[model samples]
Target: MTDQISDAQFTARTLSEALPYIQRYAGKTIVVKYGGHAMVDERLSAIFARDVVLLKTLGINVVIVHGGGPQIGKLLDRLGIVSEFKGGLRVTDEATMEVVEMVLSGPINKSIVRAINQAGGKAVGLSGSDGNLIQAEKAQKTERDPDSHIEQVLDLGFVGEPSAVDTSVLDALLKSNSQLIPVVAPVGVGKDGHRYNVNADTSAGALAAALGASRLFLLTDVAGVLDKNKNLMREIAVDAIPDLIADGTAAGGMIPKLETAAQSVKHGVGAAVILDGRAPHALLMELFTEHGAGTLIS
Candidate 1:
């Protein structure tokens, strides 16, 4: 089967298939939350950089918001910091926040920016702290007691959600460089001069909503979403999410991704997609192909 079609035929077919998508999103903004294995694997990371360059060259506004949970954990372990989690939110104390800021805003952010630049795209690295791009409030959680079954507020220190996203900086960057891609680190600043560690997915969703982006991509380890039977569900509606979560089909970290996607859609972004970043050129396939790369929630 592979020998049947020549390279020229494949190229032509791919371009023809992508024409409509390119037209639909030629000047639209796309926010991608890049993480998981895709961020760690060198080969996949290079491919991602090329794909981002391709998207920017095609006239799309590409904003990359990334997660460094695994990286952060590794650093914490190296520093002998015993980390804790409450309701899936990291217990980011002042010390942990320091490491988080350095890791997210320093190495991780610049690396992605450099990758895109090397791939022929103008790229900038930013943290929410820069220009107060993302103003956040301390995040709180509630958990039910197993014995008393009473809800109690749990303090998840230094963890925050976006209260406001100021896109002026992003606008300035975009205006100055038509093909610029911004790689954002999910670190926010509070009004009180405190730095907060935000969930990458939530941060990306907030940015997308604020920008009215055409799509928000949550690039994960899994292939889009799977049913309880482990079959891929190509598309989901915002209203259908609660039921899916209640029934346990949407489990673990995926629950938060879906929540972010639904919120992004409701807040004005066209759609939010959960796609497998482990797949080569997954982001490209999601944007430019007839058969998309993931499960879309709109």
Candidate 2:
């Protein structure tokens, strides 16, 4: 009986802690970049779907941008195609582009949409090509080995960087229905009349910037950014980003993620958070609890 009473008290405290955040972000837009382990795990996926629904129910506008790297890789293997990456960007040729489109738009997007719907959220799945929502340009070839005196250009074919975003479609959807949530697959159409694969984090950052979102959340597998001691850093200012990158703390795949976060903050997004998607109720904890569970970049 005492244990049951404690549990009830804990639940009440949790709800009380969340009240401020719910009030603060009501009617504000939050762009969530959903990827990493959470996307593949059925349990985490359901939790994520429910979290999005809860946010919507509390009057927050939620936009999800998702990745399909593992799925794409599996498809490529099945098709007997070899895949490579240049500067962490997939070297997407014509054949690979076809598979990317199929995987991202067909199964992954629909699955997320279904999950959200099941959780009582009205979700519409879309690609960047839908309604010309995201306009992208081919990423220019970069010099591969500058130190080796090799001015060779490496072309990551069909890999695009978002050049512009038309938020009119999103606005229309939001205005037409208050409960509408957009689940975007990071596949865009290029000016060259070709389908291009955009990085999900990059797409989310650009969308946040375009919409002037109040918050941008990057849900990854890890426990957010760490210092030299591997301790999670709670907050980072935009000015310190260069130092972090220079000291090798933010290298490899984390570089792009941090860069996107900094860029979003610089471009007028209120704040960007890197949260562990594997944590149960991580979204709620990060958004509502006093001692949040991730790194906040502003």
Candidate 3:
């Protein structure tokens, strides 16, 4: 933190320079997806919580959608529950879905809420099931067997994607209430009253789109979307993501994040950025500085 900026004078200058940005985003919504390395590292988590509190203090309506994959996996291991994956998505059955909900909505969600509250902000933890914030349907996919060369359906039990989202809960929270931040777990409820495990990044993107949020920030481990040489591409047009994915530049978990970011931007989100959550105050750097902190896809 000390090295990022020179000294106190620079800090003061940064605050002075950020007045316009502060004003520009005041009363606007920003949805932050908190996960990856940031969720694990104690120091990073504390920093992120403070950053969120600061954003709210500045009148930026912040909605946090958080992921707890590693935590869930850890607990599942403890319980001796077998976990599986199809493509990059988790294959969540009924038993695994129970663990997902327990860890995500119970401990992890409240922990984040507590962190923000301890940092002097009012935060309410929620799941997508609360108020039917997200209506989910089973996610579908197909893949070809290498030897058979025939595509077959891959059934990931209980896993879902966002079918619809209701923002009445958010409107009541963000617009009609006191100064509050929402920390949401990615768990969703199906129309048939079944619980579905939704991917956090996908859920966050969908929520951002539904709210017409000013910015959707996906804070992850990497610097941002990189090129073939792994150089960070500072700014990207939404249309260019397919080429990057096709050329194999975006792979693994990053592919979903890129796809989500592009889709959010297309769905009327003001801006979507993939940035390193490992860095201290990374959100502040991106929002307030001239040279931002990550790859911004507008």
Candidate 4:
């Protein structure tokens, strides 16, 4: 009986601490790029859905953009399709694009929507192609040869980047009194009627900027950006991000995530955070507590 009473007291105190944050974020929009281990682990996924629903219950508009690269690859292998990567992006041909869309828009998108709905939230699953939400053009990349410094534009077939984002559908759903959460897949349609596989991080940043979101949260595998000694850097100025990349502090997949975060902040999103998705309730802790869960770039 005494322990039960103490637990109740702790819950009340926690709620009291979260009150200010709840009020601060009410009626604002936040974009979350949900991926990494959180998507695969059942326990983590359940808690993530609950956290998102809690945010919605508090009157915060939340947009979820999800990735399914591994799933897509697995399906492609099962179907006997060969694929490769260029500049860390899958070289998506027509056949590969079909599978990419199948995985991202079908199973992954619907699963997240189902999880949120089961958690007592109304979630609408959408692909970037739905309602032309994300208009894209073929992406062009340049790589220099290591032996000789010659830069050449490499054609990444059917792989595209977001050129413009139309938020009318999202705005209608969010503004409606019914309180619908939008879960978007990153498969975009090109101007020429071809479906393009877009990077989820890029799509989330673009959508956040277009919506003028209050914050953009990228749930990644790592804790956050780390210093040379591998300690988490809690805060980073937007302008200083480039130096981190040039100096090798941020390399590999982290470079693109940082670039997206910085671009989102510069283009109109209030701020961006890169936090570990593996940690349960990291999103909630980041938003509600004084000390956020990850590196903040503003």
Clashes of 1: 0
lDDT at position 261, candidate 4: 98
Give the Å shift of residue 267 in candidate 4. Answer: 0.6
> What lDDT would candidate 4 get against the real structure?
0.94
lDDT of 3 by residue, 92-188 (tens): 9989999999999999999899989988999998999999998999988888888999998999999999999998898888984468899999999
Top model number, lDDT: 4
Checking candidate 3 for backbone clashes, the offending pairs are: none
Q: What lDDT does candidate 2 reach at residue 88?
A: 62
Worst 10 residues of 4 by lDDT: 83-92
lDDT of 2 by residue, 65-100 (tens): 999899999889999999988856679999999999
lDDT tens digits, residues 92-181, model 4?
898998899999999999999999999999999999999899999999899887789899788789889999999988988998465799
Model 1 lDDT at residue 71: 86
Q: Which candidate order results from sorting by TM-score in descending order? A: 4, 1, 2, 3
Task: Between candidates 3 and 4, name the one with more favorable TM-score.
Answer: 4
Candidate 2 — which pairs collide?
A: none
